[model samples]
Structures are given as C-alpha cells and as structure tokens.
Target: MANLLIIDTATESCSVALKYDDQVYTRSEIAPRMHGELVLPMVEAVLAEAGIKLTQLDAIAYGQGPGAFTGIRICISVVQGLAFGADLPVIGISSLQALAQGLYQDKKQARVLAAIDARMGEVYWGQYEVDANGLMKLLDQERVCSPEFVTISDPDTSIVYSAVGTGWSTYAKVLSETLNVPTVIHDKPLYPFAEYMIPMAEYLYISGESYAAELAVPVYLRDDVAKKAKDL
Candidate 1:
C-alpha cells in the first residue's frame, strides 16, 4: 500500500489527511475564507501526527473542484508546492464525488446524489453508485446547472437513494422531486473531506494515473457555457 497525503480546501472547510502503515490520520475545521492559512497547518499537523516527512509519502491527493474558486486555488497551489518539494506524484479527486464517497463510508449506502451549492443560482451536481468493489463511481455526466435543469435518466426505483451537501439542503424539495424517490437528507459531509480521497488516489495510483506537480489541476465544471462531464 502506498503512503499518501490528501488535501481538500475546495469549499468552506479546510482539511488534511495522511494515510500511512494502513492507518488514516485527519484534521479539519469549518473555516470559511481561511483556507489559505489553515490548509498548510492542517497538512503539517497530519504529517506530524503520522510522524513522517513529506518525502516519505508515495503521492499527494487533492480535492480538484467545482467549489469556491479561491478555495480550490488554495488547495491546488499547496498541493503543487508540496509535490514539487517532495518530488512525489499528484492525483485529483472531484469535490462532488468526494461527498458521495464520504456518504458511502458514513451511510453505508450504494446510491448517492451529491451536489454542491454553486453560486449565481446554480449547483455542481453528480450522481454516484457504489459497485461490488465498494468504490463510488460517477453514473453520468457531472455538471453545473440550475436545480430545475438537473435530471436523472431512468433511475432505479428499486434502490433507496440518499442526498447530501449544501445544494440538497438549499433545494431539497426540488432535488427530491426531480430524482423522484424517497431521499434521506444528510449534512455530515457538506464539504469534501481529504480522508475520503485516499481510496480514490490508491485506485488511480495502482492504475498508473499519477501526474507531475505542474499537471495537478482542479475540475471547475462551471464555464461561460453550461458544460457536462462528457462534453469536457
């Protein structure tokens, strides 16, 4: 197993997690507008708690986002600097998918509708299903759209689906009615947590998907044109 460092500042919260010796260490705070100051400290604290240097880790995983623009920038800058200093590989995980993976771990459910409140009357949305391997896989295109514009194509009524994140909280009735199912409201994973990125990074690492420090990037699903994941 690869020792990994994870960083997420793609929203109001700032968090860091370190996976070493098959154990995970994490720290986070709901510190909006403080990502620039809090992210590095959280990273330092996790590394100290794990009693390891940055260079000892196998890779650095980051929350590549469709979130607060400044928050995403902070995370990417930190990850690139750390990866460059440690000469380690870099991997990016989607903020929306992170919420689903976190829900899968916390709720132990297979179906998830993860959304984030994208300002200017829109939301960053994605649906995820846990396969037999217990990994959350995106079911369709992730996109930036108004709540009314979101749709689920031929969803299975046989399975119970759960909704999470600020977007759901903001427009619960709209999403619940749109998905057309009995939905559970969860608030624990309103922000993407770095710890949840470990499984994904490990998966990508084994699949030989690592990148250079300069190549570490964010997934800003939003653009002048309303774009879909498949369109990217």
Candidate 2:
C-alpha cells in the first residue's frame, strides 16, 4: 500500500486527500481566492487523520490545471514547498482528467467530456475514455476554446457521453447542442477534487512517473486572459 498525499486547488474548490494503507481521508471546500490559507490546513487535517508526517508519504500529487490561474499557482507552489522540504517526488494530474475521473468514480461511465469554464466565452475542455481497469485516458488533446469550437475527437456515437464540470453547468444547452452527441450531465462534479487524483497518482507512481519537487508545474490554458481579468 502506497502512502500518497494529494491536493487540488485548481478551481473554486480547495481540497486535500491522503491515501494510506489502501484507505483514503479527505478535506475539501469551495473557497474561491482563499486557497493559500485553506489548502495547507486541509493538507494538515488529512495527514493527521492518516497519522503520518509529510516525509512518510511516498510522493506528493497535485492538480496541475487548466483552471483558475491563481488557484493553480497556489496548489503547485504549496505542494512544491512541501515536497521539497520532505524530499518527496511529485506527480501532477490534469484538472480536466481529474474532472473526468470524478465522474468515472461516481457514475461508472466510461466516456466523458470534461470542461472547465475558461471565461472570455471559452472553455478548457478534453474528452476522456476509461479503460477496463477503470482509469481515465485522454482521447485527444485538451485545449481552451469556445463551446462552439470544442469538439470531441472520435467520440463513440454508440455510447452516451457524460458531460461534466463547470463549463457544462454554465452552458448546458449550448454544449449539448454543440457537441452534436448524446450526453448525460451532472453539475455536482464541477471542479477537480484531490480524492480523484489518488487513483491516477497510484498508476503514475507505479509507472515511475514522479518527478523532483522543482519540476512540479501548473497547466493554466488561458493564463494571459486570466491575468488580464485579474488586473481588471
């Protein structure tokens, strides 16, 4: 059993989870602009509940995102510090893939369309197809684009796609009409969660995908736009 600590602050949500001895403990809250303060506490809480020090963890995992610019920075920076201080390797999970994994975990759906509202009339979106082992695999490249411009690559018309994340909630009808495929949407898994990152991290760690603390990075798709909006 691997001891894993994971955190996600890529959206409006701030969450932390510890995977210990085949079990998981988590703390999460939807707190926009408060991730810097809230994330560390959540991390401490999960670690305490798991009864392990930071150094005891196998590796640190984080939601490196195509989500909020500030929130993604906070997550990667905090995780970088903790991993560096503890000499732990790090694994970065995609926010879009995590959103798809969240649905796969909760809905048992194999085909998913994950999208985050990218603002400025666009979204950061990707298509995910789960394998028999219940792991989400990205079907195509993830990109930031308008709802009309977003397209699912080689989508299974025979299967119903599960539409997930904040983008769907914000543009339900338009997305449905735009995708030109049948979709089942649930607005609850609108943000990436640390809990979902654990499974992906498990696979990556076993595949020797962890990296040094300094290598941990964020994946903000609309950094320029997000920064300009922040300045305003």
Candidate 3:
C-alpha cells in the first residue's frame, strides 16, 4: 500500500487520514462551518499519530465534492497548500463515491444510492455499485436534481439498494417514494469520511491518476447554484 494522506471537509464532516507502513491513522468530526478551523489541526494530528511527515506521503487525496460550496472550497484549498508544500501529487475523490464506499465498509452493501442535501429543494446524487475489486464505481454521472426527479438508471427490483447521506434524512419520504425500490437506509454515515477514501485514493494513485497540486479542484455538480449562492 502506498503511503497516502487523505482529507475531507466536503460535508458537515471534517476528516483526515494517513496510511503509512500498512497502518492507518484518522481523525473525524461532524462540525459544519468549522471545517476551516478543524481540518489543518486534524491533519497535523493524524500525521503525528502515524509518525510521518507530509513529504513522506506518496500523494495526498481530498474530497472533491458535490457538497456544500464553502466546504468543498476549504477542502481543495487546504489540499493544494499541503501538496504544494510537500511537493507531492494530489488526487480528487468524489464525496458521493466516498459515501457509497463508507456504506460498503460499514455494511458490505454493494449497491448504493448516495445523496447529499444540496439545499434549494435539490440533492447532489449518484448511484454506485461495488466493482470486483470492492471499490464503489459510479453507475452514471453524478447529478444535482430535485428529489422527485432522482432515479436509478437500471433499477433491479430483486436487489436491495442501500441509501446514504444527509439527503435521505432531509427528504426521506420524497426520495424513497421516487426511488420506488427496496432500500435499506443507513443512518450512521450521513457524511463522507477520509478513512473510507483511502482505498479509492490508493487505486487512483496506482493507476497513475495523481496530478500536480495546481491541478486539484472541487467538483460542484450545480455550478449555477453555487454561483448564485456566492453572488448573494
């Protein structure tokens, strides 16, 4: 396994994880609007626990999001700064995918409907199924849409999908009605975590997908909505 450092502040969660010498160290908390204050210290804590320096990492990975605009920005900017200082390559993992991965880790759920309450009556959503390698793979493009319009492109009635994220909690009735399929709702992991991001980041790093610090960027599914919020 590569020595990797992972960070996420893409939802209400602020998390950091460091993988070194086959052991993982992590720190996480659901502290909304406090990510900026919490993330760096969390990073320092994890690195200290792992007894490693930033420059010792093979690469740094961050939650590149379809989440709260401010949270996503905080994650990306912090990652860029850290990667630049360490002269390390960076990887961007989707927050939705991380949610699905967390469900898989927690329950071994292979199929997941990951959603984040995007506010404005919509959700940031994606469908994921575990690959043979056990990493969650996106079934279609991640999207920002109303609860009523959300769907499963290839619905299998025989399969019991797992539902996760704050979106399900916020619009449970509407989303459950719209999906119209059997689902087991996971209430514990409503937000993404950096520890779950390790496998995906390791996969990407091995695949030669890591990039320079300057190339790291956030993925806001609703660009127009983000812009409007920024303007206001």
Candidate 4:
C-alpha cells in the first residue's frame, strides 16, 4: 500500500489520517471553530504515530468543500503548505463523498444520500452508490439548495438508501417528504472523516489524478449565491 496522508476540516469535525507501512493512524475531533487550532496538531500526532515525515508519503489528500467556507479554506491552505514543502502531489476528495464513504465503511451501505448543512437555509447534497469496486460513486452533480429542493436524479425502488451528515439532522422531515424513497437515516458520523477519505485518496493517487499543491482548491457549491449575497 502506498503511504498517504489525509486531512479534513470540512464540517465541525477536524480530522487527519496517515497511511504508513500498510497501517493507518488517525486523529479526529468534532470541534467547530477550533479546526484551525486542532488540525495541524492532529496531523503531527498521526505522522508521529506513523513514524514518518510528510515527505515520505506518496501524496497528500484533503476534504475539498461544499462545507463551511472558512473551514474549507483552512483545510486547503494547510494541505497546500504541507504538500508544497514536502514536494508531494495532492488530491482533493469531496466532503459529501467522504460522508457517504463513512457510511459505507461502518454499515456496508451501498446507496447513500449524503448532505451537509450549508447554512443560509440550504444544504449541500449528493447521491452516491457503491460501485463494483466497492467505492462510492456520485450518481449526479452535487448541489446546494433548500431542503425542499433536494432530489434523487434516478430513483431505484428496489434499493433502499442511507442518509448521512448534519443536513439530515436539521432537515430530515423536509428531505423525507422531498425524496419519496425508502431511506435509513443515521444519527452518527454527522461530519466527514479523514479516515474514510484514505481509500478514495489512494485510488486517486494511483490513477495519476494527483495534482500540485498550488492546484489545491476548495469547492463551495454556493459560490454564485454567496457572490449575489455579497452584492446585496
């Protein structure tokens, strides 16, 4: 297995994971507004436990957006600095996909409706299903909209879905009324975890999808909305 390090501060959770010697070491905490303080320490702790420096890793990965703007910025900037300093390539994993991957990791759920509370009376949403390779594959474009506007692009009645992330906690009734599909809602794992991102990151790295540190970017689904609001 290739050595890799992953970081995520996309939601209230701040997490870091390092893969070394085919073993994974992780640190995570659900501490909102404290991500800036917690993330680097967590990274240090995991690298220490893994007994390797950042330069030893094949690539670095980070949760790339559809989350709190500041949190996403913090994650991307940190990863950029670390990867640039180490001369390592970086991979950007979707925060929504990470949430879906978390559910798959814990419950082996094949179909997941992942959403993150985007605030401003909206949610960042995506539909994901496990592929033949056992990786969560996004079925449609991820979007940010009000709870009532959330949808499943193509519904499969034979398949039951799993719901995850903070959005469900805040808008379950609305989403339930909107989706019109059988879904088991999960109360835990309300935020993306770096540990779950490792598989996707490793796959991306092996596929030659990794990019330079300067290319690391955050994906805030509501950029247009934010710009409009700023103009107002």
> Which candidate comes out best when scored by TM-score?
3
Candidate 1 has a TM-score of 0.94
lDDT of 1 by residue, 141-193 (tens): 89989898887646778767888899998988887876787778898788888
lDDT tens digits by residue: candidate 4, 57-173 = 899999997798889889988999999899999999999999999999999998899999999889999999998877899997999999999989788777788999999999999
Collision pairs in model 3: none
Error of 1 at 199 (Å): 0.9
lDDT of 3 by residue, 151-227 (tens): 88789888799999999999999999988899888896888899999999999999999999999877988878567
Candidate 1: what lDDT? 0.87
Q: Could you say which candidate leads in lDDT? A: 3
What order do you get sorting by lDDT, best first? 3, 4, 2, 1
The lDDT of each candidate is 0.87, 0.88, 0.92, 0.91
* Candidate 3 global TM-score: 0.96
RMSD of each: 3.3, 2.4, 1.7, 2.1
Look at candidate 3 and tell me the lDDT of residue 179.
83
TM-score of 2: 0.94
Candidate 3, position 70, lDDT: 89
